[model samples]
Target: MNTFIKSARVLSDGQLPKSGTIYPVLFMISISHLLNDMMQSLIPAVYPLLKEKFGFTFAQIGIITLVFQMTSSILQPFIGRLADRRPKPYSLAIGMCFTLVGLLTLSVASGFVPILVAVGLIGWGSSVFHPESSRVAQCASGGRKGLAQSIFQVGGNAGSAVGPLLAALIIIPFGQSAIGWFALVAVLAVLILVKIGNWYKRQLILATGKSAVSSEAVHGLTRRKIHTALFILAVLVFSKYFYLACMSNYFTFFLIDKFGISVQSSQYCLFAFLAASAVGTVVGGPLGDRFGRKYVIWGSILGAAPFTLMLPYTNLVCTILLAIIIGLIISSAFSAILVYATDLMPGKVGMIAGVFFGLMFGLGGIGSAFFGWLADRTSIEFIFQISTLLPLLGIITGLLPNIESKREVLNK
Candidate 1:
């Protein structure tokens, strides 16, 4: 852990990193991520109840997703850039406050418009949360960035997996008002983030007072090459998240329509898929570090193609199994991709995280809205059939320049 910090000899803006991976800070932030995303995931987990309570059409459902995702997507880059210019250690706690209010509002929301407003506020909180937290993860990486990112990402994935199950137990039966109970989660995240903020502030103080000792690692790629790589990464994100959006938002409807399962059962299946994804997230980073991120990115995205294509035609048990397989295979790409991009563009971890995460949310919104419109015209199964083809876009992974070799040379 201390190796990377010493070798990179720089964090960002001339800030020197501490000598080793800060396990306490990393685990603390992971806990905060779990609490944060667990609350956010509740929004989608409660969609069935919302649809029944409000008699919402598929299009309206899509619009709700759009509102939430767009709000989450749009502000991240700006916030990240601002943090890059001026690191705001305490902003994390402040952001969670929005989530708390949003939860209370969602609990009492009686109309569709109110629900939209509530989700929008929660999205605002997420926009602030992701990029800053990603920055924190990298800061504490001690140079094992892929491992650090995986640890950080797995928390959110685990929280995502748990959210639907919690909703099944708590909200599905108790009704929407039970959502207010999760405000306690937001409050807990805030307290944890405040402690993280103090640690971050102290790190900044220590680093800022030091004299310049070293510079960032150079990847030796030209500007044009770097830009082209970034564009490919964006396309890969689009492919990954767009397919994920369909599954996360509509897979429940598909299961209910096709198999006549109860909403609670469908939520359980969703939890299984998300749980597999969390497990997959754990391996992606260290694997990338051990092998090469390029191969991991390529295989992670493209590897799921067969299972996804086979999913729509399967029996209930088979479908559930296929979804879990697909989740595990495809979910590994983002960590490798993010860490790789940061490697390509050294010293811009926050901005890179913001762009990719924002693209993730934005593309997810567009994809959900598109699939909802398509499902209304055709059928849920039909949309899944079409959406399954999206992973084919992973073939474009071939276009990403191989920078891992360069990184190896630098390490040597």
Candidate 2:
């Protein structure tokens, strides 16, 4: 009896601490991640309203998205380099400031030109956060890359889910003007958090007795690997953006035009898709750690392909379920991809994330324009069909020799 009790106590003790100690670093990463996601998700909720108010043609909307993406993409490599050299928290705070300013500007803007400018600023601000925050999170995770990244990414998904819903709640009754007030409040909140994060980082440095100028921990990859990885990553980015842009640029039209759904209902579907993505992000990281990152990523790609194909043919219930599934697969795949890219770059997590997140999302804007053109020439159905194949390509690429294996080959 005593032996049995002792064994049970041991098992309980092990499980208890596992459930008890929420890692503070993970919490911090999650908060920053949420902020980033919120910024990205907020735009779509207001985009349809903007189009009506501004009299934007499809092409014009494409251009606005393009400008925002291109500017942010252009800035990512530089921002990433800075994050590697400077304090990451400082970089994150700077990015937040840009977001705050952009939101404030957006709230007040009346003209198309000013709105474009505000979007660009917001994009640029968002561009900086991922690389720096990701690097810090990766460092803090002590090799639990998948779990840590997922936790960090879940925050973004949460933000994304909330941003659109919150925007809808505000804009539905109060009109677009309410968005400005919300932005003002959000900006103030972010500013306070940024200050707290900065101070906390300083405290960590002091506690560790480490100088601020520690040498870069990740280095020594060959140029060939770097180029190859970047090439593959760029393709993934393009494919990702292609699908994202199509959905973001046209999902509303697809719903209203094809299905006879109300505008509000379509918006709600978009929110549903994002909310599911957040859930997926939470699941993806841990799954990636337990399974191989490569396996989890490839599986997501394969899973997403079918959903994409089904989306155009489905009714409302099926479409929403598919959207949620797609969100899960894409968010999970991307989170794993982000962690994989950071692993490839090692000490250069910030730079890799900048390229992957910022450049990819930005480039997606360009892809969105192309999709818009495609929609103009052909039907939206064709656009959806073509976009569906992208994930298949990703699945194929992921099957190629692993990055680690490639590194070994290069070293030989």
Candidate 3:
């Protein structure tokens, strides 16, 4: 009787309803994403403070990022594969608890080893959070996968934008102990996620014995073609994130070094770039839904190349403007890329999201560490000049098959 009632109810009065775009769930999940990423963003946002306090070198800072990101990256695929086979409804909240503890530990961490341990815990939390959350986003997409992903992604972008600003205001002045306050954010996230978990549990019960929605591959592509396209997408991820790693981890240093700006002022500038990224993320998905993912991917990645190439030569004002433009244009590619990959190999949403998100963190980590090491050897400005060339690799987007149109035609 309970099973029949759930089937008839079909998702709590049209909120997570049976056959439409469940905006409520999407928005709620997006909020969780926002909180999750906002907390994560605090790590880099506090780097300057950490460096000054600990008298740490750039190389040490890079290793911190490497440790955090590697821990975040390594477990994602395995966790995602597990979730694909067996969904863990409450695991989201469970993961956030790790972040909560990490925050507390970081607040009191006195030495290098303690800081590393704290960050490692936070990374573990992120590793568990992303894959399942991504699977849930897709499950609730109601066929508007691109729009759904954009909605989900924009939250993280917004969080990333907000975090540094908050850090500049709070942690920079009050010192490390202030990090403890963010644990409250994690607590709130835990509460919200408990509610989401309840909904997810009902969804599992509702879905038992039911066939999942269609996730057929693009109709005309061979397995080899699919693999080739995925490889291209991976390379695009590398380009986009490697550049972003530079910005997120080191752009403030670039500004501080070149412009002689105050630390707080540089953080505000970083906020501008990340805020622009959030706005661009909002546009990327729906545009892909309306147009095709391939074009969006191609244009987004390549379009930023000119601006990036010009960035190293510009005045401070021009540099900030160029950074905004670069952020807006380049950031849009991620949603389109992820959606495109999922479209290529349907039904394995968990594993694919895990791989891509993992790759994103893993590559971003490696890039951060390399740039840190290089900056130690050379200079921040020189690295920026060299990294700008990465986006030129977007030309490879041409090699990606036009799968969306083909799929549409086949469906019709």
Candidate 4:
């Protein structure tokens, strides 16, 4: 018992008398990120099922997604700033509570309106969770920011992978209603665990008579660099997230409508895409660290364009293979983008995370709406083709001035 308590304390506080503690914190942060991601992925995973059950059209479904994304994105910057000012664990705990409520509501709701309301709640919950949790991860890393961010991002991808498979399993036997109940129960369990961890962290601070360090205090990047980087990041994030949202919200529809695949088969492809993305997340960070972050970022942007363009033309076997390959190529840039954002605002990890994850994704929802509109007018193939050019724009933006020069201006 004593050993367990000691280990817990060490893990919670980001203290390692030796080198072994990093992995555990990395693992926990990853799991927490995954839980948050699972919530996001689960919604899309079951979109087809919902469409069947509720008789929603593609346009209406797009609106529903838009509402969720916009709400979440708009609120992120505020949540992120708050995370910077406050104790991160407390913020994260609050986020978890929102997630729990949203999931629980989703489980019991019976109509489209009710489901929309629940999804809105879930978006708010996600907005809360990401910024704060990211701050905690940065703190916990004790300075290996790149690796920490990568592992943390990978957790969300991992959850995305698992959510569909789990949904498929639950939906098959128990029905969609059962899946919601299962999600609620699972979220509750996670909430309890996070709360306990927060309580333990507070006790340790009391015991030691020292508070955890603020994100801003640990590292410093100049204001100018932050502004410049954010501008560039905003462009990239907007484009990247726009593409991701369209894929998540509509890919199943595309598979069904275009390829004539069963709903189950479409989901399987989505799972493959997410699973491959998980690998990209894992690979992207270290590659960034070893090579220059810029190269990985630009390379991914350029490399993924062809694949994105190719997605519309492929057969089932080819589409599955291409989706996985596209996942790897596109996702490889994700962690690097986060790292670059953080590097731009070195001390403001929470704020950067919020803006990038929350705002970008939210705005992407809006972009997704535009894409959906395009789809309505034309076709999914055109949407995919148009989106392929977006990353090239990102590659251009990434070529902006270095962090050092930007910092010099801020120092003035």
Candidate 2 backbone collisions, by pair: 33-156, 34-155, 218-347
How do the residues 1-412 of candidate 3 rate in per-residue lDDT, one tens digit apiece? 3453333223211123456777888898899999999999999999999999999999999999999999989999898776766677899999999999999999999999999999999999999999888877876788788998999999889989999999999999999999999999999999988988887887778665554444456558999999999999999999998999999999999999998999999999999999999999989999999999999999999999999999989999999999999989998999999889888877667778889999999999999999999999999999999999999999999999998889889879
Ranking by lDDT: 3, 1, 4, 2
Steric clash pairs (candidate 1)? none
Cα error, candidate 4, residue 401 (Å): 3.3
User: Each candidate: what lDDT?
Assistant: 0.88, 0.68, 0.88, 0.70
Decoy 1 TM-score against native: 0.96
Cα misplacement distance, residue 80 of candidate 4 (Å): 1.5
Q: Residue-wise lDDT of candidate 1 within 1-412, one digit each (tens)? A: 2332322234552234446788898899888888888898898899899999999988888999999899998999998776666778899999999999999999999999999999999999999999889988988888888999999999999998999999999999999999999999898899999999998877776665455443355678888999999999999999899999999999999999999999999999999999999899998999999998989999999999989999999899999999999889998999999999888877777788899989999999999899999999999999999999989889999998778888678779
Query: 111-171 in candidate 2: lDDT tens per residue?
Result: 8899889888888877777766666566556557778788888887788788777776777
Backbone clash pairs for candidate 4 read none
Per-candidate clashes come to: 0, 3, 0, 0
Off by over 4 Å in 4: 1-21, 188-196, 199-226, 404-412
Which ten residues in a row are the worst by lDDT in model 2? 9-18
Ten contiguous residues with the weakest lDDT in model 3: 7-16
Ten-residue region with minimum lDDT total, candidate 4: 12-21
